[model samples]
Target chain A: MVPINEMKSKCRFAIILGVTLAIGNFFRVPYAFSEPIVFIANDSVPMDSITRKELKDIYTGKTKLWGNGDKIVLTFLKQTDVYAYFLRNYVNKTPTQFVNYWRNMVFMGKATFIPKSIKEEDKLMEYISSTKGAIGYISSNKLIKGIKVIAVK
Target chain B: MKKNRMIINVVFSILFIYSAEVDAYSSDTVINGFITQGYMKTDENNFLTDTEEGSFEFNEMGIKFSSAISNNLSIGIQFFARDIGDLGNDDITVDWAFADYLFYNWAGIRIGKIKIPHGFYNESRDNGIARTFIFLPQSVYSDPWRDSLLTIKGAGFYGYLYGLSYQLQIGIMDAQTDGGLAKKFNDITKSSIESIQPETAIIFSLQSTDLIDGLKIGGSVSKWDWKMDLTIQDMPAKSDDEALLWAISIEYAKNAFLFSAEYSIFDVETPIDLYVSPTAAPYRLPYATNNVMEGYYGSISYRMTDWFEIGVYHSIFYSNKKDRSGKDNVKYYNWKDYYSWSKDTCLTFRFDLNQNWIFKLEGHYNDGFYNGYITDNIDKDGNEDVEQYWYLFAAKLMYAF
Candidate 1:
């Protein structure tokens, strides 16, 4: 049984080391994030970058007040794909099309509910350092220190 | 009994209008809502209404509401309580009542009873993670054409720039037909009638999420115009009857390899027929004529881990009843005979038992004509082949505020 071309060269080096360890464990089973990808806000929220789709439609309550009458509050994550690819690349959609257009703006009652998706970026930076007209996005390596990082288009 | 005491006084006036805005002092009057209940089982030849053996239904309640009314306006309402025959009794309905205006985060506008943005499940087709199967895709989004009850009274426009999103809509109301079976096949057409005219509609959608990286795609189109009493000589009869719809949907999940799908089509241009067994002696039977209908469906899902994943779906429908006048001469026009054609099928299976539960199993096979009348067969050729088969099971539970 021995030399059959050295067992076909050890089965072609074990099929190229099992396809290079199954593509190196299919992308090394970790999508970065040991923290630092924050965008807390409320440092007197003067946003820009197409106002990040009006700050993700005022923290997902679909922009209720805030041409300076403040009143938007949101902090989400808890279902990562890098938090739906940074709000589908800051509101251009697709994280299931911005969760199917906010589940059709929350079943057509036009707004309310949909933002408070968590998964400990230190408990969403301790509720965005004790909430207050809060806005969110974290994991540029969990950027702690009293969050604030706006600027996305 | 007074419509179940006016649906228990409109569900205690929507729970005393959200507990009087949470006992006032809630500044910026904001109150949210979401509650859905489900459980359904049906087997006996299932294809909408094909009763044969397995039967179980729950789907007890549904709700949606939003309030703000200034600071750029807002107001909304949605309600449902279907499936009343299992002591899980219900039939309440409201469906939608809207109003919205923004003008910032990329423009906004919405007006009463709206939705009818036809396809891609008519605007989130009553959420549940926007679709993971527990029903929908019945040859293109369930419960017939008036998806999410088409709402309408008109007005819509929503925008989002950069990542791309655009929607435009137009409306006009009062239009009904689809499984509420209407019948009457000549003797010069008559047998309980109604058309409630003035129905107009339009919808458009466009979407993109910055070119792939966990994709999202969109496509939508809709058309509706009805006004008819039945016309053919010189044509201008006006109960015009029209329908044209389109759809494309996609969703991709990252890291765990999840996927989603949707495809749709429906075209109708005036078709209706009704007649059944006119008394065995050349009975002049089976009539419920409607020509030109179309359908399509496709679905794919994969998760394979993270609380198990599996999915499959397929659908098809095309019964626009045509007789383009090549007269197959069914015995000297057996009362102006006209049969339709199209293949029909449905298949589905899904299970997700985590993050708030879900489970579904589906199977269906249809060959056409159930309520649009054909009385199980007569006349040997109005496209006789009303075959059917069905089985369904569903379960759902979700909670989050």
Candidate 2:
């Protein structure tokens, strides 16, 4: 019993609402959306910034010692958006490739330890803050106090 | 065989206890293991087993433990067992045990039984989970010669220099000829060969990883001297020979695609006097003076999805590079038509059932017969006769953690 014009407008509104809901569902997954990754280090470390190549070398166990001859401690977040971003950009490798590389390194006696994988952001931040020569990454917005930010050059 | 089974049981028991102990001590300790069971069959010839009627003799299992004893020192050991047709025979053996000391990033030393770094895939050859194919390219990594090339009992110096990673190993290997090589020699000379032992061996390899992202180019060279004692027509004979092996490899991986290629040559030289019969008129056996084996293969793989992958490769091997046509050797030795080379084209499919399990199916179209001894493809009249062209199908299930 509705007018033809009103029915057409209601139909249009329903279609728009359906499309909006679909888009919302698509973006609801946080990992589907890209986010910037920020590298953090212990405050005791003198270094402020690291080049992309150096960062790659560090994560791959190529550069094991810091400039001051302290053993470099590596930590990582377990399969987060920031971890994926770091692996893709800084390491220039996919997550699977990075995992395989580390496994090979460990089994071949090229490395002694894989980077410590932390699931909680608070634990990662605390580990970075307490350990000397430690390096890790988190989302840019999750930067915490007591840890120094390392600018990626 | 019972003794071998007993040894396997004991080894597994020890491994379980050790794994538990290590787990209790530190969570950092990693205990990784893999088990793969495979089936293979050929149309006419017995390719890697008595596979004329589909064989299930191909199996591999391994366990390893790695622990960091100190900040800069770590120790690792692996126990492995394999039964590939009749080659491995279900014998449990210590694959590798090493202690590594890292003085610096540019310098490290590994002491103990160390895995030899040969071609690009030799180090991880046994780990089916890490490779695209159930069987690696047999051209460069011949199944018959695995024990000789698997590991060395000595120390190796591995480090990075000027952006180049290098490893040098000087060791002595006790190469056993209880496998196909012995059978081949016995078939040729009507003799029983006990073993072939290497007095000395050296291996050197170098790789460059910084030149390109996800690209690795490397080369390796190995030299060894071996001595063998055999009975020819119930008479004892001794011989010594020197072998030289070298290979070049290139691999590139980008996103979901991977490409790899390797070429290798193996050369053996023996004194003509060693082949001569002391009591006979002629001083030399009917064997070629210089024996050269060469091969190359190229492969490409694509990951269609997170759980599925497909790959194909073409591998060619020549038992004697100088006689590519295989006519000269056949005429001289009165062997089969395709005895001097093998051309293998293979297709493979891999399914990642889960994070810890994998299943693989592979098909191969092969032309020529270089592995008749390993496959036991001898005719009833005790002659080397096999089909020139054949097909092989293989399936493997693997689990790793």
Candidate 3:
């Protein structure tokens, strides 16, 4: 048996905590998105399209090698909306949680996947075009040269 | 304080390397580390250190080097040093070193000094700046046992099956002779600990992350064995210990709010075949009984702003499951009943000064001494009395890359 005392104190603390959680959950916190995210990859990628589960796995540092045994390189946009949209839709994690996941993996010595952060759309396109097996997300639906906008099923 | 200077140089090296972008995990071989200086004090009673008087003996610094050798193989290592009151004393040691091989998304193996999965955050417990609290709840993540329980030397298997992720490890204990836990063991035996060596260990971890969005439920079970080398009257004696531990954890994160809870138990027996060997004669410590210890806590934290966060938790622990009253110690050792349990209510305020700097303050209302690793009733001044309740205050400043 545990020896935690003071029943009344526990009740009061629990009430206050419950109320705080309710308020925090009631109001929608920022850093959310409804914008569509387009997936872009290099020509060296094995598959022309990807699935939600597959993308989630790749982003979380679970699947490092592609189906054809090529290393999967990941990239992320510096913008908040596109990053939040992509993560929420498939990865089921906030940006903070996503970063922590990778950090934890690094701390665990996995060193498997550390996504390159790109600041702009043109630079992201140029990098993906030049870098083989690289995949990234952009908010723009317009097609760019030297990059394949892989369909997300 | 020369170690502080060395850590400063190391910190600036990280700063110089990633000046343009504060992303330490940018390159192929990620180089990152953190430096922290902390202050600890208590209204009464000493905690880990001379907390009755404010002390800045709390400091930790570590650096990690990690890289992938191939698409499916990687290796990494971290070097760490710390000082908390009279413990650690800035001893530099290898925190963890491992070579990992990935067969598939559902299967990977780690060989070398693999992590021990106790609770949800046990493997990552030493990453202070990466976490929100200066100290995790004492209910399960006891501070004295931090280094001793961090990792084991052996191999580990981890992967995701269907929606369940699992980590299985088979190894030996990484017992340190002069680490924090060894000091506590000294308190337990009232004798000097010469060394603690590994014997046997096995752990299994399982979690379900797909059952709910932003929610996770996990459990871990482990069996651990170790031998302690002690000196009594200049004669060396060896004692053996066997323990079984298990933990259940639940966490949910939504938006900026996070909630977590865990319950754990440790069933321990010393001298597994007690009194059967002549080597155990005249060296056996009293009260080395088969006992079950339990701990649990519920915590909540919210990121109110980009720069600020707040968290609170109520943690509880018991030294013995069958006798929560702890009366036996009084009958045999003339000790207080409260020595067998600990209850703590903690609050913390964290401020992220910048991407690379962090500051935080914390306060705890403590009700017992068992979880504090306080076995002796005497203070540093040899006072034989103790307080039933006390307040502990702590603050920390950290720089990380």
Q: TM-score: which candidate is best?
A: 3
lDDT of 1 by residue, A118-148 (tens): 7877776676556655667776755367556
lDDT of 1 at A52: 51
Best candidate (score: lDDT): 3
lDDT of 3 at B40: 95
lDDT, candidate 2, B216-244, per-residue tens: 89999999887777766656666677889
Against the native chain B, what TM-score does each candidate's chain B reach?
0.28, 0.91, 0.91
After superposition, the stretches of candidate 3 with alpha carbons farther than 4 Å from their true spots are A1-5, A8-12, A15-33, A48-53, A87-97, B1-27, B232-237, B272-286, B373-377
For model 2, what share of native contacts is present? 0.12
lDDT of 1 at B191: 35
Output the number of the DockQ-best candidate.
3
Ranking by DockQ: 3, 1, 2
TM-score of each model, paired residue for residue: 0.33, 0.86, 0.89
Chain A TM-score by candidate, in order: 0.28, 0.75, 0.82
